[model samples]
Target: MALLGGIKEVPANQNSVEADELARFAVNEHNKKENALLEFSKVVKVKEQVVSGTMYHITLEASDGGQKKVYEAKIWVKFAWVLMS
Candidate 1:
């Protein structure tokens, strides 16, 4: 319990490497299952694609107390382009 929110973000782009790092961090913290699901660890990666413009990806990982105890998901940050342009 309470052994979360300490994982550092990967200094990379919107690629699979960042996603895996996020999963590892979440799994390490998920080992402790006493705390509630309120607190978790996440990684944010920002990338500038010449073809697609600028984008930000946020990956959140949490523990669910199941066979696949650890889970991570990502969402694209849409406002980065607006701010950049």
Candidate 2:
């Protein structure tokens, strides 16, 4: 999976299930950072077939001192790689 940016090709054997799993894993990994305050983050949207791959929009929600905050992250998965910007 590509973790940064740029165009990437999706492999013929790749399927939506695998792509979704990878996207979820990537989001989990990202949320594990020390500065990450998000809790129960999940993939809210998956936009696919626009350019031979899938685009995931993840929603992260957190509570800070009783205040709720939300954030969005975009991930592109193609073939055997994942891209984030």
Each candidate structure's TM-score, on Cα atoms with residue i matched to residue i, is: 0.27, 0.38
| Residues 1-85, model 2: lDDT tens digits | 5545443445534454654565556556666765554344333344333345656554445454456666555666676766889
The candidate that wins on TM-score is 2
Q: What is model 2's C-alpha RMSD?
A: 10.0
Among these predictions, the greatest lDDT belongs to: 2
Clash count, candidate 2: 5
Task: Report the Cα lDDT for residue 8, model 1.
Answer: 38
lDDT comparing candidate 1 with the true structure: 0.42
Q: How close is candidate 1 to the true structure, as a TM-score?
A: 0.27
List residue ranges in candidate 2 displaced over 4 A: 1-27, 41-49, 64-66, 80-85
Residue pairs of candidate 2 with colliding backbone atoms: 1-81, 1-82, 2-82, 10-79, 11-79
Could you report the Cα RMSD, in angstroms, for every candidate shown?
A: 13.2, 10.0
